[model samples]
Target: MKYTREILSDVEGYVPGEQPKSPDVIKLNTNENPYPPSPKVIEAVQALPPSALRKYPDPLAVELRRACAARYGYDGEDWVIAGNGMDELLALAVRTFVDPGDAVLTTYPTYTLYETLVRLHGGRVVSVELDGAFQLAEAFYSTPARLCFLPRPNAPSGVCVPRAAVERLCAEFGGIVVIDEAYVDFAEVDGEAPPHCMDFPRRFENAIVMRTFSKSFSLAGARLGVAVARPEVIAEFLKTKDSYNLNAFTQAAGLAAFDDYAYMEANAATIRATRARLTNALRDMGFDVPASQSNFVLARWNGVPSARQIFRALKERAIFVRYFDAPRLDTALRISIGTDEEIDALLEALRAILG
Candidate 1:
């Protein structure tokens, strides 16, 4: 009757925020792009020949790799590996780099997936909790923790850390440094570049920068993620990955996304503007807002209703948003910025609730 590992008796696997079945819900929960992808994505998918689908997708995924390399500021496709999405890439990294009993370090109240991924690999997690202001500890630089997983403009709270911290970690930590930039483009679109250690991979040996097409590129359904690292590190990851990780549809769509950079840039700008406006609007309405650099905002109320109560109230109004029960983030709600209309609806709901 007892088949589970002893370590898993209490460890809960990560539950992604709700993707409610009702399309009527104004989903500001998971930070998904409110905009549609470029018209070219539609054109590319439509243009895909039936023959491509019949074939097993390209194992090397050459074209996707090239596009990813260019996106990450690398000159060639040599060290870029695309996965089904960033989530898969992270799982592969843990499997490829970590052996049982090997410890990996991450900041808690960051990406919950890192804990699940490492634990599944029989690797122990060493975590430094977010500081008083909900930032990663400065001690991470002095402490040589193995294989740090960092989320830029970290989720659940859009507060960003300086890039110098990542560089310092890479310099000091002997193990790998995977900088997960799922929200980086959205942050940059918001006019904040909190420093990324992506360039260090080419110069030093242990750095890896990862990205996804799901967020800024508005291709969540595409399920594509790319990792940029030294060629050798990428080779090691390739050994761990399933051959056909990136399928034909994703590759084609991603290429179209890269090619239609102007449309992508415009959408990013609109999202940025909306993020700023929503943050200010929420703050003005008496919510304690974090300085958000992502497409989402973390807001705690000014001693009105508990975060849980507000979340439930919003859900009752047929609008969906994120509410976390974890200790560090228990008192706040993470709200993704949607379109102007969506924001207006959310604000209207908040006003009604407060009154």
Candidate 2:
């Protein structure tokens, strides 16, 4: 009676953070931008003509792609490919590059979706466990695989892999490397230039850098994402994408947001400030917090009130943060940087719960 492939029964799909229904709840599980998107984005969406919906959108999303390319200093639109979201582009990479039973590399305790996508495509996942500090293990370099999904400012941990390390991986790893830069916008920098791998696509043909509008651009609902690579690599991605993958409204909104890139920068600055404060506060409260470079922090609680108890207690109070039950993460709670007031409320709740 089962019509699906045998693999379907064994696969447990990626579980996203809880999205609460009530408006009053201080939802911080998902790493969404707490502030609104650029005003230009709102204006652009509103300005879309009703007739625009009557026809198909641009199959390649050229305008949006060009804008993204220009922003990143890419030579032309051929180097950029837009998608429904980063997730779609990720799936495309797997579909275009992987054959059934191929080995796909990913870091342990990283984004769970990477493993799910590889398994669903019948690819084997070779997960290299990160070091105690959450840095890439030495095995990551020598591991033989057809593709590698590495997130800069990695999810859950928010620790960015060193730029030199990435360069080494690209130079040595024989297969394609997809550097998922989903939270690169929030990465704190000591130097004038921000740390990023955007230039890798130009220097290394096997490197593909992916970005999402969901976290920094505040366009999660619009489902816009972009992939940057050598034109040859992008050509294969373009072949796999759906015709008209990006609708008219999303294209307009993403373009407007990209044009006003300063708006996103300003918002990112605010989140970084809030993240510092939250990190210090959590540390003061006895949680072992790593110096996070993303919009969220993973706080490991080792004291009287266990992380699970704190998560359950916070849930009862309608304040939500992320708690992973996986190994090395079981003792930690990942908290997204919310508004100043929202963070204040959370701190107050933790004080009450711990006492």
Candidate 3:
């Protein structure tokens, strides 16, 4: 007999981007920061006490929350909560708000992990299909779910929905809306004052914004994410979160990284520049490249050497990019912007493959 819950009988697990072992491979599959973490973060990690590992981490992550709250202009530590990663925080949101047989809403062809998380909680997934331009359909506002997760500058496409539209949705949707802004840092990196949805929680009582230290902060390996919400909502999230989810070392690293904001901003500026160059290069090579606000661009080959063929050919040449076989994404490869050298290598490999 199977020793599994009824929900497990037909559920498919989330598939993370591949992490190949070969050091020589030019990996651009996962949206990891090609740059190293801030020097201060490295110093903090190096300074962690070995004895701290023997004790439990602060369950509330007070200092880290304070730093984050200050950065976002939040009133107090009660408005923020840290997680092992955005993945964990997403899961926690589902568990806290979605009951069995309840509904979870999101856009079709999003992060994909959102669907898996809802299914794992035995919640119904109501996916709103994006229109021909990959924009959210009007019906999205009417979705009656217990919770909704929306990714700005959505994945697999790298297109950002307008801030006004998101605000309108938050005003219309009855239930909780979680704005996943894992890539918002990229969109606003070069702007003098980029509009962030973090303030949505204050405006609409039912909204929350999620962020990560991975993409723009160059801390993918450190695995830190946080949620910004109203104090009352954060209190409930704290009730659902696992104790000691953020370890002592990670807290130290996050604090150090947050302290050195200028360093992270410089790296983000570099990525923004590289992303623009990469998008233009792909378009020049006859690929359908969209306007990307994220660190990655989705390039689709409409004719010769389809996406799958190009993906395989690049892998053979020790270059890696992400190719999804799902609907609406089968013909495109999502390429994360690496260093200038790496982007040049990928472009050269693509040229050879196309020829």
Candidate 4:
């Protein structure tokens, strides 16, 4: 039963942010989009033909790719590649262009999945730890990896590196830079931060920008995501992916989801507003709230009970949030910004826990 590779032998797999199944707990885990996707997503799927189940989905996902390009303000279908999720694309990206022994660097405390992907490929996973300020490590400027994984608003901390930093990497470096904009729409604290790489990566052939239907699009269940790159990279990824990785329903749903961007935009606005309220409230309650630019707040209770204690207390009250058991992040809780009512509920429960 040891068919697993050596990489699997000792390596701990990436833990997802968390997804509690209980209906009672206000699930503030797994940075999932709290709102439902566009109504068109529902309508499109409802009208999907059952006959599709009999045949395999389009291996290329041409139409869905086209819709993605259009959404990103691109000219044609050449810039986009669809995936079961951006996660699949991440794995494929490594296998496609990365050499078995090449170095793949990513920010520490980022989507850990990136590290797991590189390790599984027999590649060296070099992490440049974010300094105490939560910015890119100096290693990024001093030495660059052949590939890098970056979440635009980043993760857990939900802080973004400056655009100057990204441009500096793209200019001085010689490898493909992948920017994961999974939560960019929710990354603005007051509309004064970095721009989404998707909004401009077409200008740089070496830069690859990824977008997901999971967060802002609110289609986590649909599991659809797209990566935008120079036409050259798209062709390479096409050659690397499973011929039929995306199903027919996903294509229909993703297309419809784009058609109803306004619906998703409305929901994003609500999350932003609520995120601000919670950040401020947490600060008032003596927590060191990091400036969150995503639909979540990262807070460390000021000399209060440890993050583990707060996590357990909330669990008993049926409220779920993400707690990373790593070193600097040990005391911090990454709370997904939910609906106003959900935040209120969490606060009410917290009051009791601390008292």
Candidate 5:
């Protein structure tokens, strides 16, 4: 009586962070921007005419694509593509590059969605484990596969791999290399320049850098994402995208957010400052916290009041943080950087729970 494919039945699918409905809860699990989106975005959405919704949106999302290109230093719109979210674009990458039964590689303890997408596409998933410190292992560079998903400022751990190491992977890997820079906006920059792989698309034909408006731009609800690569590679990706993948409202909101890019930067700076305070506070409390370059930190508790106990205790108090039962992460709790007041509340909660 089962109508689905065997692969679909066997897959466990990706589990996203918990989304609590109550307004009383202090939510710090999903890593959403604690501040509101740019005022320009709000105005743009409100300004959308009723007529705009009467017809189909631009399938290519040209205006939004152009803005992204200019912002990221890409040559033109042809080098970029927009999607419902980075998740949709990621699905497109798997469909475009991986044939059934083909090998798709990724680093373990990375984003689980990558593995889920590859599995849904009937591709073999080859996972190379990150070392003890969450750095890329040598095997990640040499692994043979049709496609590789490398998330800089890697999820759960929030550690970033260096640009030189990324360049080496692109130069040597035989297949496509996707640098998932979902959290790159929060990483420390070098002077005026950001330390990211946005420029890789121009230098490496096989390199594609993907960005999301969810984290930095505060447009997660709008579901906007952009992919940058060589025009030839983008051309192939365009063929696989769904018709009118981006709606009129999302396009307008994303473009407006880009217009006020400074707003996003200022918010990111605030999050970075808060991240430092959160890390230090956890360390002072005897938690093993690795320095995070993203909007969240993984706090590993080694002694009394185990991570699981802390998570459940916090939930009972209506303060939520992320907890993973997976290997290497079992002892840790991933906490998102919330508002200063929210963080203060979490710290106060931890102190009470530990004592």
Candidate 6:
């Protein structure tokens, strides 16, 4: 009974977003792409012969990495590594770079999984809280940690840090800096290009940028995520990740999804449009909604019905959204941008509840 480690006995684990099984639920609590994956993904999965499962999958996921690299101007598999999901890669980053009793850093109110991963490795967490504008504080640069996890277009709040800020951080930080761009595809940052930090790896040897097929590519259930960095860092990650992390089917599906990039782009465009409409509607209804660059909006209204009341009211109506019960986030609701129909339903529900 006492065989478990002391840390395991005392630590509270990370809680995932709810996945209600009911078909009629609006189901927007997690930021899953409401759109389906490209037709190619479906075809690839269907074409996978049953016999292929007989053997162990390719340990390196060579072809899938190459295909993903081609999109970002990387030369070969040496620059990237795939994982079961971003969660796995996050853990891998901790294992590969952080030592027991070392420190890992990230912004406060970010993806909580970073802390969990660090804790699992017996590393300490150094959280730098964002300021009144929800941007990184000037003092953030001074916090020293061995590995830094920065989510560009951060989660929960869905606000991305500026490119210059990131460059400065990478320049000054002594250790590794990972720009988690899991939601970057959904962001149209400069009006001309997709919001991303992929090029950072080339600019700074200590920089690593990670992406996932879950959001824009509609492969959340597929559990596919990739990270790009210089060859040396990538080699370290390869040593840390599981040998068969990317199974045969996932590799196939990811390749097909990559080949059909246009499909994902179109869906991302639709999501951006819906996000704009939803944000405007929420603001019009007296909610303080931030300018979201990701597929979700963080809204807080202090008037009539509080955020918690609205969360409960919506749940009673079979509509689901994310409401954090922690400090700095208790008053806000992170609502994922669903399809046009789903957004309409949510808006109608909110209108009725507030009225």
Each model's RMSD to truth, in Å?
Answer: 1.8, 0.9, 1.2, 1.6, 1.1, 1.0
Could you tell me which residue pairs clash in candidate 2?
none
Question: Candidate 4 at 112: error in angstroms?
Answer: 0.7
For candidate 2, the 10 contiguous residues with the lowest summed lDDT are: 185-194
| Deviation (Å) of 227 in candidate 1 | 0.5
State the lDDT of candidate 4 residue by residue for 1-355, as single tens digits: 3787767886678877556666776898888877778888999999978888989999999998888888789988899999998899899889887898899978877888888888888889888888887898767765657888778788879887777788777776667888888888776634653267775566677888888888898888888889999898899989998889999999999999888888887888789889889988888888898787788888887466777999999988888898888878888888998888999999888878777
Q: What is the lDDT of residue 209 in candidate 4?
A: 89
TM-score of every model versus the real structure: 0.95, 0.99, 0.98, 0.96, 0.98, 0.98
List the candidate 3 regions with Cα displacement exceeding 4 Å. Answer: 189-192
Local distance difference test, each candidate: 0.84, 0.92, 0.90, 0.83, 0.93, 0.90
Give stretches of model 2 more than 4 Å off.
191-193
Ranking by lDDT: 5, 2, 3, 6, 1, 4
Which runs of model 4 end up more than 4 angstroms from their true locations? 189-194
- How many residue-pair clashes does candidate 3 contain? 0
Provide the lowest-lDDT 10-residue window in model 6: 188-197
Candidate 3, residues 320-354, lDDT tens digits: the string is: 99999988789999999999999999999998989
Model 6, residue 193: what's the lDDT?
57
Clashing pairs in 3: none
Model 3 gets an lDDT of: 0.90
List residue ranges in candidate 6 displaced over 4 A.
none
Q: How much is 206 displaced in model 5, in angstroms?
A: 0.4
- Candidate 5, run of 10 with poorest lDDT: 187-196
On a 0 to 100 scale, what is the lDDT of residue 113 in model 6? 90
User: Which residue pairs collide in model 6, if any?
Assistant: none
User: Candidate 2's residue-wise lDDT over 1-355, tens digit each?
Assistant: 2999988888898899988889999988999888899999999999988887998888888988998899999878999999999999999999999999999999988999999999999999999999989899999998999999999998899999989999999999989999999999999678334599999999998999999999999999899899999999999988998888899999999999998999999998889989999999999999999888899999998777789999999999999999999999889999999999999999999999998
